[model samples]
Target: MEQKRDDTARDAVPAFDWDPRSEEVQADQIAAYDAMRGRCPVALGAQGNWAVFGHADNRAILEDPRSFSNAVSAHLTVPNGMDPPEHGPYRAIVDKYYTPWRMHAFEPTCRRIAHRLVAGLARDTEVDAMAALAEPFANEVQCAFMGWPETLHGPLREWTRKNQAATLRLDRKAMSAIALEFDGYIREQLETRREARTSGAEPPMDATTELLGEQIDGRPLTDEEIVSIVRNWTVGELGTIAASVGILVRFLARHPDVQGDLRARRHDAGLLARASDEILRIDAPLIANRRRTTREVEVGGRIIPAGERVVVLWASANRDEAVFDHADEFRLDRNPADNLLYGEGIHACPGAPLARLELSVLLQELLGATASIEPAGEEPRRAAYPSGGWSTVGVRLA
Candidate 1:
């Protein structure tokens, strides 16, 4: 029962069922994605890539890595942009960096960063969650995690914005420039370490310095390789982390009961973490991930040819009515395994442990610091495509 479409559909490609960057979608992404999921789960985009919005389709795509490859990027992305046989080995290198022991070791520093940000928020006043809270917390934590200097905080924030703009424009030149700009920052740290080692002086023992000693296939990781790896980690840590903060803060503001419940049990780390996942599941922070088809596939009654592009819309899939009965309701009792907050299959997020820890700690601090969190005067502004969650959420803390 595949939906019939002529070769012209293939020729035009992204016959885009809907514009991801449209003013309508940008105005209310969740509603737009939800409507698409219900009406047309699988559709070709304007660029010819099939947009998969249903939960079942996304799960099947994620599970069948053989048919859906992760090598969607032209640039090197360490483990994230590689496919199996190659993916597993590089993934091993990335996994060693996020072990429970590492997260435990980093918790104190992570909490200090979270606390400093939360404590700085003025009480009973209107504050832009993205500017005064979310962005700074994400930036400082990432810098701390990478063992980068505090001087990098401002540049990295600006870099995230430029990277997002470049991505939205699909401007390879701007993308390349921003990427090199990022590389220069990373390379500066690497050079400092090299100089310290040459002078027989000890360098700072941090993640960046530790990465210098890592080897893949029995050879030390090259500067280019290390930069690529760090770049991937930085993007994951900074961009999504900021989005998650804004989303979480706004969610709490909108739902006072949920906020009050969590505030009462603020000491319960496990409950708070699960709540974070549920909140994110209802409103995704990272919208979509791209994949390339290895073979022809039939999904959601549509015929997709081989060598085509695919976009898995997490914001829609997680809220698919088929899976979550109410879809939008925040329920703490829902099964955690079913949630795709960290993705699925071999390419699942390796930094999830660290992310969970950061989120749990941040929520705990916010609840403890403020008596309540509620919406401020202006309506929360949704972020544009390529980014999910609120761009500017005004919240009043008391």
Candidate 2:
């Protein structure tokens, strides 16, 4: 049967079935999401948004972009926010920047940054992995890759913190302020390039500069479009990259045998990459992605009307017990295609190749630098909504 719809859309929808921001949900996000996955796979959430937790339901939404539109936000999101036909050309542009050749070319610099950060950690002391390792690794590598200034490292760090806080509260005013603040930073880069073009001075030929010259639909990309593309890339570098590092380090720390096994096979990049994906599968580095229903749809036994908001919870779906044999167990034998770590379908993460390279290099460097990495006395503080992984991962590096 097709989805049944009410004449009136959002207002007619029932009140939120679950409170996503309640203290209970924030206490332990994975556990809470798992509970929802079992009890109500397609749950109604605050603000008329529906949270799809089951692997099947989430996969359905991801596979059928027509039914679930990507235009969920009012703000422009470049390729990510645009649905198909329009999404393809822009996606092609993004894809070229992260091709195998490009990643291979940049691998040395990425390795150097990762090595420097890992080597500098104080020995025989407890270090917050988020600070000494995760955040800096992301900050430095992003700057190197984008031809951005090292001075941006601190400002971007603060921006990530502020952005996360504002998002969790769903504070539109603060979120708008945070966004404009980021735009100012990007605008400065654009202005500098414009000056370089006028004065005949050379600006670094990097990703940002390349974007300024990119054409779309036979016309040059607007500053708005360029800024949006860069903003999405920023989230990947600052948010997901840092989160992945903390999660990777903390997971290895908790599983000593796995850490030892990885240390022994450190030179085997493919094996190491598989292990990284498996670890992240158990604990996702990204919590969710939003979608707006394009038509009335039935998902996981729930009938969602057209124009309703929907959220695909990666943290929950990747760990769905139905898909993976031992959902909670970290094992490398599982199929990579089944994992939604880099997502699936056309809107899949474009920076995946770069992400893999950065993480693989970081893993090699991190394992080589440490005699052992073990959890310190304090528990790892989990980051709340809009951010995944630990906010502070405490570990003793010896």
Candidate 3:
């Protein structure tokens, strides 16, 4: 039976204080999500926030952007932090860049990069997949998409690492410093492009150039705004891709039979992509995304007052027994029609198509190139963030 809300209970809701940075705490996140889904789907969180776990309730909150605001920070997600009407325009700019044609154009480059990375690992007996393969693969692809030099990969990776640390700290000073560093870099690049234009050289088709061409709210985007958008992508992409690659490889290694089947059905890359979604459903990179409640709303039979923070536990919701049968098992045949890995509604990740394309291509390349993959000696190191996993992954290729 679901718990009912009371005036006394409203004053003090039973909640869990989760320190995402702690390894032990991070390990317990899944268990916490499970327990919350089983008993109190909408419980109070440590920071006095409402945590929503049930699949239906989480979907409701995500879909109803008016009831739960996404505008947590300005200058950083443009409209990822915006709601509905305000979000539409900014999102259009991003959506255009991720159009199927544009992503398809990048496919050859993506596949070449994946093949090169895998080839590099071909000689090594045992490798840290995160560093040797995933990081470089993602960094290079991101650089290619931005039309930036591959030389920027090192600095970009370092900056992403620093930004993740700063975000986890939620420190204003560190964030400001990082912002300045990125701004300086981007401005210098813009100036160089301007100079090159005077020489009659055309700038490359890339996000930076595209953003420079975009008009938001009927005004051209400023350098700071462009930097903020690019910075968000750079900071968010690497870790998740690295973690995802690790998870996929680990999953394949554990189930060679499934790997063989996918390899045998190479013509069904789309099916493989769907199977990848199921893999994500079983071990979602992100545990939860935070939203602010607009007013008093009843979710999972509990009342969340206005001005309260709501943590939508997508990881839990994807595995909710009410929504998925045998939610804990990894089944490649499972349909991902309702998966929440990329989230839902207006704020759903706009770069999802690009990400999916990249992951699909990467897996396809791997299946074609390698005979088999088996676990190496070392255990993988998981990231501290709720959205992160596998700082280091050990794997041996057959």
Candidate 4:
């Protein structure tokens, strides 16, 4: 049944259920979201967006792409921001880059990076995992995967920090500037590749260069489209991947028994991968994705008007008690198809396979290399909205 609320009038604006930026929510999004899910399945947030907290509601919205449009932003976001017929071709192109063959080919490179990072950890000392390992692994692996040079790593890391800050503040001017800044970086790479190919020089055949060759509907993709696609990929790689690392580390440290179990089964690649997904499901890394309602709809007994913004709380939905036996408990045997870690429907994350490979490999290396990973004396700081996981995760590796 729809929870009690007097704002069922056709055009009436629903009262705000929670302040997204309040101290309570910002301090601990997981706990705050879980509480909100129980009280208000479909809530109107202080930011004028409808926050859908129930697993069923979130799933319904995701599956019905026609009603909940992905075109929430004024700017182009490649396939992610496109819908239906428009989203298909680009999505197909993106999917090719993450095929089984591609992931298999990239596994060795991923492992070498993971091995080196784990090897460098200072044993028995408190190290800020975000700084010491998580951020660096995210940066290096993304660069390596994209075939970007080492010099771009520092710039990309700094750019991610600035982008997250601007997003949290809802600074439009800063966001636009940041977008342009990223565009410049990607455009430079494209131009350099174009020049290399033009001069008959051997250009590095990386994802960026390969994208230059992709044709959509018998036409070459525009620079705007290419840049947008690369921007999205980079954001997922650098931001979400890093966040997943911290969340995984924090979970393992807090649950030593689970950690030991994982360490014991580190050789079983399939188990390791499933275990990573389970851990991430318990503490989502990507947070929510946005959509706009095309027409008035009732979600979880709440009337949402036409053209309204909806935020599907992935961080909350994945942990819904109604869906999972024990929402907060990590169980590898749980159904993988039910987990929305990479989301669902056509808009599901295309980069999921690569993310799984990266996280799984890193966990294996970290667990195999160290005898134990425990919490440090320092408290970890949680990342604010628009980012999930810790901003600083201090752990002692022994």
Off by more than 4 A, model 2: 1-14
Across residues 11-85, which tens digit of lDDT does each residue of candidate 3 receive?
Answer: 685456443345565655666578757776777756677778888998998899999999765455676877889
- Per-residue lDDT of model 2, residues 230-276, tens digit only: 89998678889999999999999899999999999988878888888
Give the winner by lDDT. 4
> What tens-digit string does per-residue lDDT give for candidate 4 at 320-378?
98888888888877888889989999999999999999999999999999999999967
Off by over 4 Å in 3: 1-23, 74-76, 122-124, 168-172
lDDT (Cα atoms) of all candidates against the true structure: 0.90, 0.89, 0.78, 0.91
The whole-model C-alpha lDDT of candidate 2 against the native structure comes to: 0.89
TM-score of 3: 0.90
RMSD of each: 3.8, 4.9, 4.6, 4.2
TM accuracy, model 2: 0.95
| Worst window of 10 by summed lDDT in candidate 1 | 1-10
Error of 1 at 90 (Å): 0.5
Residue 396 in candidate 1 has what lDDT?
Answer: 94
